[model samples]
Target: MTRCRLCGSQATASVVDLGATPPCESFLAAGQLDRPEPTYPLHLRVCTDCWLAQIPPLITPEETFTEYAYFSSFSTSWVEHARAFVADAVERAGLGPEAFVVEVASNDGYLLKHVVDRGIRCLGVEPSVNVGAAARDAGVPTLTAFLSPETGSAVRAEHGPADLVVANNVYAHIPDVVGFTRGLRSLVADDGWVSIEVQHLLTLIEENQYDTIYHEHFQYYTVASAIRALASGGLTLVDVELLPTHGGSVRLWARPDGVAGEPSRRVADVLAREKAAGLQELSGYTEFSARVAKVRRDLLRFLVEAAERGETVVGYGAPGKGNTLLNHCGIRPDLLPYTVDRNPYKHGRYTPGTRIPILPPERIAADRPDYVLVLPWNLRAELAEQLSYVHDWGGRLVFPIPELSIVEGTS
Candidate 1:
């Protein structure tokens, strides 16, 4: 019985299996091209008691992030998002040269760099070695280790309490969620704020974003579920903001117990909207598997049709979500000639399981393929603009999940 990691709820309610898939970030080395790719069962289940959507236990964080490949600084849109987030938070929180800020899972210090530029003391707790080194090189001091109650306590003892603790897109990745959140109680100052950004479970189900499922992403969160989990760890939600990033995410501002942190009206409003959308009910889980299956079917049909017509199809953005979508749809080199990535680490590699080569974006211009499939559909607009040069060849871009559509004015 795989119990709920946060609430210890042992009721294994509804399981939606997406069958064997490879580690989303294990984009293969170039030499291993011909070798058979390994995959593991990709199944998701909902905790009936807590209403948390989670994947069954399989891989460990060490297996996922030790030598992580995905670098956040590579994406222009993501960097811009990070910069804007830092600017707003610093201003909103009155964090200036005197404040101390900490960011958990601060991959390559993408957001912290902006905070550091303001001369405020900032620290990063990152588990991945390679990415941590990159951040250090960028002059962002980072602790190359996982965040836990012990680490948080030690840090608090040494550096004193933080004014702002940010965990962007990381609340969903933690396994020892309760312990981690408990740790927050030690590090966050009495008047400090801890902001967590997670992909909303309500949005995931309503929008059919099953592609977000991957081993690294252990939990999908909702405002109600998050408040419940945080309350258990002695934190209270103060405010909530819905963000447009990652197909729709929520930023929950919290503080330690008895700190006068009341859950905002927006929090209640969002939870009400979530309940109205049926996230608290079992019916929401019923159609997700079928919707995921439909995604696989529709995508395969489109890829095979494109292949049959002798129209070459390629993929853009070798993101973790793209890996899930590709592996689930069984896309191979034959279907997607290759995928392009801006990250140099993934440039010469092959996507795990799918074995589709990940080359530089130059491949898109050189090949002049008929269609370029935008895998990270959330960044479709940015990528489309970047590849507008494809218009010269009369080629068009294709976005599969959410909906299948081709950009106009090109082949």
Candidate 2:
């Protein structure tokens, strides 16, 4: 029985079983041809006691993040999102020159650059060597190590307590939730705010985004679950906000006990909404598995039918979520010849299990396939609009999840 990682609760309720899958970003290298890639059992379970929705253990941070391939600076939307988040934090926190800002899992200093530009003392704690090197190249001071209680205490001794600690999209990645949260508790000053952004579990179920399930992402968080985990370390949530990035996400601002300030109405309102949606009950997740299975079946049928008609189909976006969807549905080069990505580093590589070659976005215009499968369906609207010229040849853009549908026209 897979026990909850946070609390030693053995009563784990199975949420959604995505089946065996490789690490989402484990792209095949030329030297790895002979080495058989390992695939782990990928399934999510909800802790009945803590309501923590997480995938069973697989890979560690050292194994997954070191020499990482995914770079945050590659995404245009994410860059802009990071910029906006920095602006919001500065104004809301009343940040000034005296304030020391720290960001955990700060990949390539995507958000920290903005904070540094304003002459704010900031440091980024990142694990990935390649990304940390990039952060240094960009003139952002970064510590290349995983954040833990000991490390946090050490950093605090050197730089003093941070006024604002921003951990964006990292609350879900840590294996030891308790230790990581304790580290945040230690590093932050009494009056300082610790803000974390994570993809909301409610949005994942509502959008039927089973593709978000992967090894790197250990936990799926809701507002209630987040508060419960934070409260374990004596932190209280003071504010919360919903964001559209990565389908849907929640940004939470927390502080230690007796912090002065009224709890934001949005925080209470979101928690109530989560309860109303039956997140506290096991039945909510039970229905999701059936819905996801249906999606897998329908996507396979559509691809098989299209192949029978001798139609050419290619994929767009070599994102981690896209890899999960393709690998779970058991898609191959037969259905998707090759996917294209804007990231230059990923352009010449191939996806893990399926080994579908990842090419540049320009390949779509050159090839002009009959149908283009938008695997990163969340960004389908933006991608479809950009590639609307495929309509000149009567080609359609197909989105698989939430049912496969083709939209005509090119921007």
lDDT of 1 at 154: 90
Model 1 has an lDDT value of 0.85
Per residue, candidate 2 scores C-alpha lDDT tens digits across 1-411 of 468887778989888888888899999866675689899888898999878899876788789898788789877778888999899899988899999999999999899999999999999999999999999999999999899999899999999999999899889998899899999988899888899999999999888888988999999999988987887777889899998878889999999866936788999899898888888888677799988998899889988998999989999888888889999899999889899988787877889888899999988889889988887787665777777888888898988766777777753
Give the winner by lDDT.
2
Candidate 1 structure quality by residue, lDDT tens digits, 134-161 = 9999999899888888998898988989
Worst 10-residue lDDT window for candidate 1 reads: 402-411
Per-model C-alpha RMSD: 1.6, 1.6
TM-score of every candidate = 0.96, 0.96
Where is the poorest 10-residue window by lDDT in model 2?
A: 402-411
lDDT at 271 for candidate 2? 88
Question: In model 2, which runs have C-alpha deviations exceeding 4 angstroms?
Answer: 260-262
